[model samples]
Target: MSKIVKKTKHKKKGIKIFSSALVVLDSKSLVFFDHKTFFELKFPKNTVNDLEIVGLENLNEALHKFIKENKITSNNIIMVLNSNLFFEKILKDSGDIYKEISNFIELTPFEEVCSRTIQLDGETRILSTNKKLVTTIKDILEKEGLDIQLVIPYLALDKHSLNTENILEVNGKKDLDQLLKQLLPYNLLTENTVLNGKPAEKPKKEPKRQLFLQERENNPKSKRPLVLLSIFIALIFVLIGLVLFMNRKPPEEFTAPEIHQSMPLIAPIGSDQQEQTSGKTVENTTIKVVYDNNLDSAVLLTKGLSSLGFNSVILEKAGSESNTSKTYIDFSTNYPQSLRDKLIGETNKIFVDTVVQDSEVSDYDVVITL
Candidate 1:
């Protein structure tokens, strides 16, 4: 007997798919809106501790990893900036909106501000943020193959919400409907969203017209002062280079010493002798943690370093003096090309101050100031 043969196709399984990301940025955490489900992630403690400092390098890594592991491949991203993170100012109805915003931002207290403007009905509103934070966010998102569709202030939609008495200003369904309508022209909707029981098509956006919230006016006084300042700096650097070359020291020859039975915990600059100490000495290096007023943090750092197999001491601002003067190696210039790569990689792992000044120390490889 011959049996009829049939082929059956199997569908793919266990793949989580997401079309778009609605990223809500608040002071404490980030909430991602994805297909009727919300995922909230808290910022690590003290990540945004300073108002002026928004260091997101570590957060960027974590976010990118999350997106990759979850198989989220959508390119569209919409950001809702919290009122705490964004600044808003009303621009007066004047001759030039751009010029008014420029003058206003100059007088604002914040440093390195980036701004965007939007005209609603008849009033113009300026949305402002720290330039560094915006740049870092955009760079990270772009690196993850995502493009920012919209960056709107959280409070901007609060006005449209029905419940305005709440301090948090959480919006309702009506506000969301209004926001969706407002962003319709920008084609911010994904393919899965439905309108009238049919899939909504992404609208075609108009061609680019002009740059947004940028200083376009060609004022002679705007950049000439900066140009002159640059020339002055270049001349100063040239003068310093000449002085350093004229006073340069001669190179000294070095010889390797014979191997010893035991290495010293703390050795003199040229001596191989080890000194006896009551406290435990770790390895051949000593790390000093310096702080102005936070001795608690310094102590914590000392304990942390101790756990990491490094001998560390806490330096208080009152009675402690740091000694970093023993090292003779200029990290930037005095290394072979092959060793330079490894040396730079190692140095970057340690956080040093911008202007490093060598202090006096017997057996120290690095000095860190907090």
Candidate 2:
């Protein structure tokens, strides 16, 4: 028995060195990411309702097809499942959490359930989900020689504190937003949630009609002053407009400058010298500067870049700690190398030896991190 156990341990050790993948399972899709690099892989998408036999069949078929096409062979697998399927309950007593979870599962309507328990403070949190789905994933992967290491509900992901770069690889913004809402509720949504990584304007919550009317009624005097001020402002604006119109100069009489083409233009020393002497044309480009709670440094850096003739903006300030304080710069793959070199040379003091990489930033030429 000891010899057999030794052999098993040796086999487990051998599996760790190979490239592993994380399989993220959601209601509508299954995404595969090369775990170490977070490089995403092609995977199948199937809208599933595990409770239904037909849904499960389609999901199984999709998984089978993915395995066959990819020729996946190994036992290193990490699974992140959608939280919507999980059922969480709080138990008052600090009794055996596992036992409580099993009892809750037995009473629940779900025919197939798996449970996980956590003891926090004096209370027990029990989370249960569809066991059939988990089993299906395991069986499918196992058949393809993939071994499951961990299975976690997406909401409980914060407990593990997995790499955030993995989250960045997920394909869709809608899916990313749903994942963020489930995984990290306290963290404010940022531009990173979108595929392009450009800041997306969040829809402003409209004021409740009844509340607005009630507040207006309560402050009737406030409304009159605002109304009068609006009228006064409008009159002032009209007077200013009339005065500007009167001061406006008539179209300047066209007196064309004498043609200077007849004079031979003196050539510069060399083409390169001429190009170097040409005036710099500033672009109307916006650069996104994302920082980790260090808004003062970010603000100062933004000012510095703005002074250097680059259109810069402080894109985001992450409320939480990032994995690294080392800054990063991401720009277009085709960005001019000379400008890039100059940018790094000038900002090297502030950003240090930050590595630059390629990324998609909507309406922005580059993105910076600090």
Candidate 3:
């Protein structure tokens, strides 16, 4: 038996894993899944009114605290907005589809809305939602340092289903799991499918402009030959004048008046002058302020920089792994010292604990990290 016994080993294949987190949001609640755990948060009763998402501040605070406690990184997060908040319709494949979509949006009850369209075999599916709603939610998530990969409407999951009215409504864990299963294989986030609405159409070329140029180029009696003839005649006149001048008698020289010497029109490039010019140039340069926890201070600093004639933008740093104890001013090595001092001064006015350093790898001329 020992001699006849033989064992065969089978190899175990690796399973495909999803590293991204999926978040489903509705007017009432928000559901999050990170491949291993599921969490849900319900909004206050007065969260949504007829006009806007009124509970934005509360929602922002809740999201910030939740993300911090859970230690969720800001990377590869997908947001699915519920279908109840959107206006969905399947439009016929007309020649100008976007035009039709625009008309549809105009006729919708919502005053300002964003739309996304998907073209099927013969029909186009268009989904639109209130612009303010999407913008509010986007700002909230971004403020918490979540890198949103895609903002999609729930109707996109089952576009062809007849009863797609409430198919994507997440009532409990089972519903959320089913929705995730369907969404696992869906990855169509083209320009036309983004929450910002339909992709902008390229400007049509003006045929009249082209026609005018073409006619001028093709005319048999064109002005090119006339111009060349006129130039040739002018050259002949110049040559004749030169010959006359050579044969003429020389004029008597008159005593020239003594001229006084004046200062040079442009002063020499001194070190101090170069530094001043560099400082002026840096004043107009753009400064980027990256913030993690203190958004208010970042906003104030941005405004202050703008007031000082320096164009500035505020960006929320992605992830909670930031040194929030002290603010950092990262300037390029070639950045002028005077300009750096001014930047540091402005930053310190808003953020008290500040540290200045020269960075060789910074993308901007000046980056203030808070």
Candidate 4:
């Protein structure tokens, strides 16, 4: 385990700096810290469903009542979300940390989640929470006119010193206080952190696989096998050419034939016939266009597909709150390769960041996301 550092600022002797209120929220209770003391508010039974606060009105009333009774005046809030609402995994530090994180998220079963990464000594700590849960809490806090400074997971606390089961007990208050003192300096969540229920945009860089290939190609020791293979292939081609040269026949067989032959005439297909054939082929293929914060682009693309004689429909757009910028074209496994190629080519012409993939369980033959 690493030691957490408590940051202290040097100020003039008479200046007073107010401390921000720290609030710990879990499935069972809500703990509020004010003036170096912790206040607990236990939720009623059945109020929480699946680690989410389902009774919004009751929760709001309870929170306001607790604040009034406790006289907690601080508007700056630092929230600590308990483990029940989020998932945590410590991953060994790979050279390509971003790619590793992406792979982990893709493998997870959750479709919509907010994730944050913290770098440790030799590992990366990933904290992912249900997006809906986080969004609900944020909305409640914002509605109360509170400024949420930072939001972190309960895993940030020292496991050895603090008991996870008794997170709000009196015996652990000292340990929890010390941990919060250390965590406050880090400012885990900043303005730039986007936790708006969308996957974070990854920084553009060469993938780890491509970088490894480039490194291998640059190394002289690794080039021997490639050089040998190339030489062997070249030798085979050279021998083949020589065999053809040796088997060459003399060019003394140019005598014209005396017998006359009748050739069958073929009629060229007209434009209308070509149109009907293309329309029939395209009409059999159905396309669904889905968009996230890009309805205009999706509509235009759908119209373009319709004009091209393909059956296209604009599916319900994804949540506008998402910040994903990439365009994706998903084709069903049974979809025709020719149609897939045509759709992919057209999509690429329209969107610069186009990703082509095959979805085995897609309902539509083709699904486009803009």
Global CA lDDT computed for model 1? 0.49
**Cα TM-score per model:** 0.38, 0.34, 0.39, 0.39
Candidate 1 RMSD to the real structure? 36.0
lDDT per residue for candidate 3 within 69-186, as digits (tens), equals: 7776645566777766667788765666555655666655554466666544555677666766666766787777887766666555545341222222334456545554544323
Residue-level lDDT of model 1, residues 147-177, one tens digit each, is: 6666555533443441111211214445444
- How many clashes would you count in candidate 3? 0
Model 2, runs deviating above 4 Å:
1-18, 35-47, 50-57, 70-74, 94-103, 120-123, 164-370
Pairwise TM-score winner, candidates 1 and 3: 3
Q: Count the backbone clashes (under 3 Å) in each candidate.
A: 5, 2, 0, 0
Q: Give the runs in model 3 whose Cα sits over 4 Å from its true position.
A: 1-13, 16-18, 69-71, 93-96, 120-122, 159-370
- In terms of lDDT, model 2 sits at 0.54
Reference-based lDDT, each prediction: 0.49, 0.54, 0.61, 0.60
State in Å the error of residue 45, model 3: 2.3
What range of 10 consecutive residues in model 2 has the weakest lDDT sum? Answer: 1-10
Order the numbered candidates by lDDT, best leading: 3, 4, 2, 1
Model 1 Cα shift for residue 156 (angstroms): 6.7
Model 4 whole-model lDDT (C-alpha atoms): 0.60
